[model samples]
Target chain A: MMHSRAPVNAVIMPRMTEAVVDVRELRKTFRVSEREEGLGATLRSFVSRHRKDVNAVAGITFRIEAGEVVGFLGPNGAGKTTTLKMLSGLLHPTAGEARVLEYVPWRRENAYLKSMTLLMGNRTQLVWDIPAADSFRVLQEIYRIPEEQFRATVKELTELLELGELVHKPVRNLSLGERMKVEFAAGLIHSPRVAFLDEPTIGLDISMQSRIRRFVAEYNRRNGATILLTSHYMDDVVALCKRVIVIHRGRLLYDGPLADLAERMAPYKIITATLHDGAASSADLDAYGTVVSREEGRVTIRVDRHVAPERTARLVNDLGDRLADISVEDPPIEEVIDRVFTSEQTTVSA
Target chain B: MIRIYRALLVAQIQAASQYRVQSILWMLFAVIRPVIFLAAWVAVARSQGGQIGAYDVRDFAAYYICLSLVINLVTSWNAYEFEFEVRMGRFSPKLLRPLHPIHYSVVENVVWKLTTIIPLGIILVFLALTFDARFRTTPAHILLFVPSVVLAAALSFLSSWVLATLAFWTTRVHAITTLWDRAGFIFAGQIAPLALLPGPLQAISLALPFGYVLGVPAEILRGGVSVSTALVLMGGQVFWVVVFYVALQRVWSVGVRQYSAVGA
Candidate 1:
């Protein structure tokens, strides 16, 4: 909306051709009924069932273009996975209008299911006792992939994931990371146009995580597949998503560039500096910025974006001899989110 | 669907191969049931002048042996499998797949029995020798019984599918399955032939699909049924298979709806 005549809108705006995914005012609530243990409680519940409703996702709306990879960001219980389940036809919204790739997902028709894939980490779909290749073969049948196409895709994915050595090992024998890689290969062998990855790298080590990240990125690039990724690790968001949608407490909080999010919630950048002398006065540092922490001339400051350059320049020019080392950095993404979600509870504008 | 089943079968076999000790243990251990029944029935026949319900002890031996072999082939463990799969959230992955999950589970259950059948057959053979029971070979009986057992397998699979899908509602389909298992055991003629049960229980056996799997086929194999009567019972198995299949479809839709409501 800020860019009045956005050029990217022409080719990429999810248009009349049919939004690949459209969700508006989506809502889901669970009726948590109290169950009495004994005969008295049972009889009481029969007459007066105490019901509590937990609103998992409340009045959320969004759209995805034909081939956009959008990151879904939210703290646990913020309804990110709930939304994903609705999109993938695993769950239905209690009240809402929604569509995925031109089909009502809760219907979960063979046609709609054929064109989409869901991959979740930690919870496995593979047969635990079998080789990963065996699991992959089963997927081919489930998706009704043509023999040749299934072969070709399995070959390509196996090579891309470097799964040759790992694919034949029994699933129970494979390391967690190895199993996840093969899970991806099995999920994607059908070459679905839409992929929902929920915490797909949840428990993987750094190297394995990056390997999966690269594989996903490469797959998207090659096929122009639309992706909806959810992860707790902020680095996953930073590495994979250009556009992110943030939700908190079952409500949409922010939908925009990730960089803009960090900028908006945390308006100030962090700076750590060490001085030549341990006796630098804390009061003197206030002129430069809000002194977050100062210890033996190892001072930390929060400098507002507008004043960061001038403040740093002054600190350098005025305290040349006193300053030993200075480094300006962005606060961790988690801190930015904590402020946005917990501290300021700002209503999201899409 | 068949293709999906074949793949799942291959995978289950691979999984079974991983723990050779456990796999063998399961085979040797579960084999006790048929032998126990065989012994009990043999004792009954001996006390009753080597016959009960027109079966000499030798005939009872042959009947129970064949029952054990075919029952082992046809029975499914989905009721137990679903309890775990549903309770632990393992059922989600199957819902995510494009194929009907029943196919995956059905194939795996049948394949697992392939290993157990030998032990079952061995126990049955042992009974045949010890009981001095009437035993006979009839090409006609084999011809009719084979397809009856297969149809029985389908019936068993679909009934359990309906039962397992109830997880979406109560989350404790396990308790319900215990009843189903007991009913299957009694009415399906696991403990004894339908003819040997009291009159009222026999009526209930006829009303349910259980006897069609174990009793009807085993009945014919023991020279109990005329070819015409055998034809009618086989028709009954086929009929119930359709009924159970349709029931499975209805339960699946309702279960899926309930699962959606629960956000499962």
Candidate 2:
């Protein structure tokens, strides 16, 4: 196994080309009141309140280049949403600095706001009682989109999203997936250069999720916009993001190309072999590696990444006539991510 | 900015029109308070030999009817609504837009007032016929009343917005808004005419901004105020409008900094 740790406070300098989004040691602390679930505690809280500070975002630093799609990965309470809020100007950080499009986000200047958008899956900006097209018209006015441009954008979005009749019906009458599609179209009406998407595919069916993933990928491809996306679904990350930033409990655990995540964190490979008819029993496979599963003439083993090649070669040689088929590959991304979070000593940078 | 307001206004009107039944019901509900006050005052005037403090039955009817219309025009619920928006994290979407969130609230208020105007007019006609109300108004009073009402609405909306911005620090603003409403009821002559109050209370009513929000406009419309006095009251309305506008800006800037954007 191989591992390396960057200093927690290390600062990574940006490249020659200016980054579209840059954050340095951003932090947010919330003072939340506490009380027991009883009348006595409630009465006492009125006289003397008990409060505690929660560090929702603890000194995270990252830079995103223009036109790059980056996956922001974390478990629940991992501060992904907090960081997005700070960058989108929905929240003011307790400390540190962040610049998006060369403007301080929290200043919320019109020029800054005009250049970016934040889309939350659980929330909606469309007026509930009106058709989504009407809401889109309002967005056009708010963003100051010209009439010709607004019409062309709407046409392109409708064709891309297949929003045909959905835009004509009131938003309240639409299904969740239909509403989400409309939401995406509305959020992008201005063609924002920077987009922060928080769980944009959440709670959608598998087919809808795949559709949304494709839409996001195509949107990025066509517009060349920089996007920071947060999702619990591994499929979303695999489909769209080339690079990922992982956090745990408000601490940055990893930042690198997605291809290197498993190599750096799991440090292991999985090998599967199909034995010939009655050629060798499961017990005979012990010398090769840790047998993870053996059933129906197939045996799967976990081997350290460093020696996986040698082990596979030996197994093939020993079972020359007995081995019908064999394959070696990295472990599943979900499994690798799980290992990264569970392994207390695991942290890597690239 | 005006274009954005126009778009919001159109959208709000479309949304509000979807709930016509609810709007009419709310308008009817709003009529109850002024009607009850008018009935009580008229009864008192009758018992006091057909007059009390320069208000006969007809005069009482005119005052209450005008008060009802003025209240309807200037009423703002942003204080209560803003608290809910902040608590439930609905304000986040508004903050993301290039326009200020206050623009949405302002347009919604204006659209709501506009949508209820026909219904309010019918109700006004019914009330006048039932109470035998006689209004005394000159062209001068009528001309002055328009700006008075506009200024009153601005003052009321801005003050409520300032109170609403307090929700960033205290998520529950019901108590604060209730206190404000109580103060308006006392000092704005919503409960009784300012002339009928004690001298000390009359001075307090004149000194506070609430009288400008409700009482002055109503008085001007009923021809109870002379031209010079109407000018002075309009000046007072303008002063409060500026004060509340500045206060709203200051409070809103500080409050947005404190926003936690909870619930998502």
Candidate 3:
């Protein structure tokens, strides 16, 4: 749940002192010029620019407490990355207030900077021509990490990520997954207190993504650091975060536990049944419910959550001789999210 | 801060080493420019009865060799790097660090020049020996040249950084930097001796910081300036140092704000 802080003496008293990240009405807007696609129109635009303001992040408020791993969910162009940039001090918000560890992020005070890190997938901060270890050393110096602590952190991260010899190779020579691992190590050389990860596993293989997810979870458990992660992959969120904040078109759509979101948006279950001896075709099961798929002898159907049990019982009795096995389960998270977005579209159009 | 700088410098040098072929090619470019100028000036001196503007053929050789060294020590390509970084969205990662991004440029420039200086020095010596060029450096002149070269490098880097900040506003930064480089070369005595220029042009060179970058250092090494003149020239270099420092700060602050607003 989100809470509103009192307005009195807000400057002297930071809102949500207990929260590691406190954001209120955070907003960012860009004034982009509209230019026609022609040489003459381009020249005309130079003389008379037509600028339109696009709000990348509207007034959205949320707080993340210490040690909490919060998932930031949004589609492309939904302001997720913009919000992360603001929280990490890369971009100052056009309006609204944000405090990380009780310091205004835009101020970027040394203590604040030393206590946090931002990692963006598909972008690298490492020196591409040198080994990642060398960049790690640079970070150690820049963050003033104590030698013993730096060594220990390096060892721990290396072990966790199984980064054997990957740190020794030049970043340009490393594969995407290897590079991402090194990036994580580089960003964590100082063991920052808060990590803002934007699409950190975007291009990694499934196994590599799972490894990173496990490492993140372990890091949070061991250090109790706060984390804010944004990813298009639902598995990343489902595995690493219990709570998720869904945003669309720079607006907050929902904020709660992941399971609650699925329940609220998708009130249905999938019924997968196996035909004995492959006796029945997939078309024969359409009378039961919406047929999702029929592969081999198994058929999957979607049924209303409230009537799923009754429907399964009727199917079992009706197909007693033909059915081999049946199971009922919640719909996949992707489908739930699709429903959420579809519902939001309906509300917008309405 | 010192430790951080050392680490950054080491990393940059390692990066340069990784691209050694490119570094050597860049050094060759630097060497060729001065050699070309030396050949033209030597021809002109021989045509004019072995002397032109107080420099004989051998003296011209020495002047150009020393000019090449000074240019190598002071020149920085940070403007180009900054333009590329801004265009490619590389500045976003740099902005997240606690250290100011300018330090990265500074370290890269210093390390790159340091790594390239050995090859440049060998070329200078080869030209000096081949052309029978002589330098008139005393211990005092040498001492003055040290500070002069250091200040020139700082001025060059700061000025380049200031120009690089233009990338925050427009994509045509390359043209602006090219114009600045032309001004630097023409006025900084890369083409000819500062004293050989017309009176008004020499005055402009003396008044501007560009001449102090290469021409003054070359003059000091060539025993052209008296002790008093050397000190005055060094003072002028320090003045520009302060001016460029302030300009860098102003430009970086404004530029970063603009960059953040524009998301580049």
User: Of the candidates numbered 1 and 3, which has the greater lDDT value?
Assistant: 3
Cα lDDT tens digits, model 1, A1-350, are 01122211112223456678888878888677878589999889878888888888877777887787888988888898889888999887899988998899888888988899888887777788777777777777778889999889988998889998898887889999988998898788889999999999998999999999999889999898999999988888888888788877677767777777777778888878888887545568877888888788798999998888888888888888888888887778888878777652432332
Q: Sorted on TM-score, highest at the top, how do the candidates line up?
A: 2, 3, 1
True contacts kept of each: 0.76, 0.84, 0.66
Query: What is the per-candidate TM-score for chain B?
Result: 0.91, 0.97, 0.96
Model 3: number of backbone collisions? 0
DockQ of 1: 0.58
RMSD of 3: 4.3
Q: In order, what lDDT does every prediction score? A: 0.79, 0.89, 0.86
Error of 3 at B218 (Å): 1.8
Better of 1 and 3 by DockQ: 3
**Which candidate comes out best when scored by TM-score?**
2
TM-score of each: 0.89, 0.95, 0.92
In CAPRI terms, model 1 is classed as: medium
User: Which has the higher lDDT value, candidate number 1 or candidate number 2?
Assistant: 2
**What level of docking quality does candidate 3 show?**
medium
Order of candidate numbers by lDDT, starting with the best: 2, 3, 1
